[model samples]
Target: MPGEITRFVLKISLILAVFGASAPVLAEDMLVIAHRGASGERPEHTLAAYELAIDQGADYVEPDLVVTKDLVLVARHENELSDTTDVGSREEFADRRRSKTIDGRLVSGWFAEDFTLAELRTLRAKERLPGIRPANTRYDGLYQVPTFAEIVQLVRAKEAETGRTIGLYPELKHPTFLLQDAGIDSVDLLVTALREAGLDGADAAVFVQCFEVGPLRRLDRLVDVKLVQLVNTNDGPADEPAMRYGDMVSPSGLAEIADYADAVGVNMNLLFGPEGIPSGLASDAQEAGLAVHAWTLRKENAYLPPVLRRGTAENGTGDVLGMVTILEAQGIDGVFTDDPGLVVSALAQ
Candidate 1:
């Protein structure tokens, strides 16, 4: 009987050697990332929005970073400030408006690159989706655009204050556009700021993300923090020389991405099939040793999958919890949502 017990132990040891002792515990808890800092409740990319998101129990808060004329890294969804700020109504800055081609499209607006950081401070944030969330309109024009350094400082202070680790997920928006139009390297500015704050290492509570592969590849070399390569389903314009986001989901493409990125941020549709069930994309990414974080899970019906949407009204409610459950089952590592409170509550259950 002793010999039999010894043999059993040997077998267990061999199995553990082959599979690794912690293999069974490798599964990560699904994270709730505040898409632009509980953006459903407050104007995005503002200090108030980020503070509100921390209060609501988000694991991370995302700030899409754009550069100003003076090379200051600021948080804004896009360099164009027409939609998310009151810049359009500012008569003093009306001359700043100009039509320029960005990302293969001609857009007329007050670009962030055209304004100095001090000039930008004169503008205030507004509700980007006031039609769906009219209540947010009341808080519009109350908050100022926050700098990347300011956001990092806020998160660090919050961590010390709350005793809970809060992470920052900042995306390099329109990298190609910034390079071509403004002749500024967004990644360099971002890395410099992070390094100054002592948040440039692999263990730092930060994730630098970008849609364009060029910037992310460059960032991978510049910073030690984790990087996420965002994947979109849309094809690039014919004249655009960049690779289409659709191609990045292929097995070979994912393997290539794993070479530089720690994770892949995909559109929710990439994870679903024609039947609206979870697809093999998540598993494929897992096979490539890449974490998957899906994006933009909003409460409004228009933003949800057809089957999950509740009422006919565009702004009506939807089965956000149901959608989240499906993604969790698909082995998603994190979810980006405008309503972080709802996602946090759903995950707890």
Candidate 2:
């Protein structure tokens, strides 16, 4: 009970520090997306982490979607299970381990594609970054890998409970690999799932994001929901090997992307220059009629620039408030973060 009280006090203090009030409400214009839920605090892609993000006032919860052997969609950063699950320790499934080339890279592990949803349910979730987020390991082995359908149900329930219209940001992980290499039609699976959930329309509070260009273009025709084209700093989309991501963020590239995608979800580095000056990429994309959302704003020192890091410890929280402030000043529409409450706090200030 004393520990509980301490936690409650900390929570309220955090809220008050940013919002200057007891309630944790967010502004509607600038979006706070929970990258794999509050992954900084809990295991990524678990229902527990997602619920925590929603409770912390995240507008959207991101679930990187991968398919099971039964063709059901589940939330995982990648199809590989060993990193985020206890599949490696499960003696019963030891034989299931094998190597396969996914998206042109050879990966060896227990894959979601090899397991039916029932088989996956038998495994438990663990912190993917146990080295950096040691505290999150207390939650390790406590959650099951959640289905996208289950996530939708959780969101709908939360919306009703909170009276806030929460949004779903689902990324199709390795769509090209699922299609060409694994022989699964992920686009159809996703479209069918969203349609069944009544979230396939333009008015739906959802964004279908992908790193590949071809799938987003295909989705644009099939679904009315907004599409986000994810761009990396150095690498291009796997499906479009010859096309550089650098070109995609250019004026011409932004124009081309605006043709199909509603927004560009770019790596956070693209938004800032050497001394954290605003790069014109956000404004440039917006000028091309695209909303700009940035990927992966984390509080940890490991993920932050050396200037922003708070301590020598890699796991220590950094100047995320300052990072979000910079991105907000650049006028980006939304931010993806592992620590949603921190971002919410930053934006609320």
Candidate 3:
């Protein structure tokens, strides 16, 4: 009788410990999206970024895809090559350098549209913000610009090894600009590549994101996989002059989006309300039952919510704990951040 009692006590103790450990993680649904794959710790969109994010316990690693002239999909923030590479320094390809408008803004850089995938492969990927993060300069020309295919390979390996679903979230960057102007559309090409990698449709654990309504909606029509709509401070497409963010934040707009999309990816500033803090929800967003995923979080000062800024310094002072807490309270489904490890650790703590 005594031994049985002791064993029962130990079993009870173990159950209590597990419940305690799981309590914090169960408080809310917190999806850690490696914003451009742990970008705060590595050069964004490289294999190093994706690997580190997975290693750090990110639920999803986001890769933004743009097409090259040869129709190969490559991971990039935009079609432009200036900020993320040493392309500007190579005068041999100077003629390839030209200015173009993307989403109504005239950007001066070497666009991916100007280069074949083979030609782009010759250039190495580098830290996008060398000015703010000169330390990243040490790795300026080491890694290749990874393709969407490579990221799928990494995720496939993890899923096979662990039997846990590690997902890939690829944003179709500048879809309207790429489709109409560059003559390359992501709907067909990306879906096909994902299918090749065995990550197509809902069963594949791949979620596609896009800022323009038409592209994400178009993708929805093409595939059964989940679609995420990205909203920003920028203006809507020329055809949709009637719809803008100031108005989109209205109840009517969010509901319309909820009809087509599984989730809404909003700028952190707007969702959290510019205070460097997360506001619970805009009445409109909550009513729509649209899952909210906030974006572009970094450990940098420039991206920090205003409420968290302490000094006169222009950059981040590494104060992210309060913001995470606020996000938890706001009931966010997922967050896009350059430091997924930091976010995961904060939630765990």
- Highest-scoring model, lDDT: 2
Clash totals, every prediction? 0, 0, 5
Local accuracy of candidate 2 as per-residue lDDT tens digits, 1-349: 3344345335444644565433322324789999999999999999999999999999999999999999999999999999999999999999999998876789999999989999999999999998898999999889999999999999999999999999999999999988887798899999999999999999999999999999999999999999999998887899998998999999999999999999999998887666544467887898899998898899999998776677699888888776665565556799999999998887776
Native-to-model Cα distance after best TM-score fit, residue 331 in candidate 2, in Å: 0.5
Better of 1 and 3 by TM-score: 1
Clashing pairs in 3: 275-307, 276-305, 276-306, 301-315, 301-316
Taking all chains together, each candidate's TM-score versus the true structure is 0.90, 0.91, 0.87
- RMSD to the native, candidate 3? 8.9
User: Which pairs in model 1 have colliding backbones?
Assistant: none
lDDT of 1 at 240: 37
lDDT per model vs. reference: 0.85, 0.88, 0.75
Candidate 3 local lDDT, 1-349, one digit each (tens) = 3344345334434553655522112227589899888888788999888888988989999998988888888899888987887788887899887778777779987988788878888888899887766766788898887878778888878778777878889988777777788778777898788677766667767778887777777777777788887887667644355778656666788888888888888887676433222233433576697778888667766667555554656554555655566566556788888888888887886
How displaced is residue 101 in candidate 2, in Å? 1.6
Ranking by lDDT: 2, 1, 3
Task: Name the runs in model 2 displaced over 4 angstroms.
Answer: 1-28
Q: Residue 182 in candidate 1 has what lDDT? A: 84
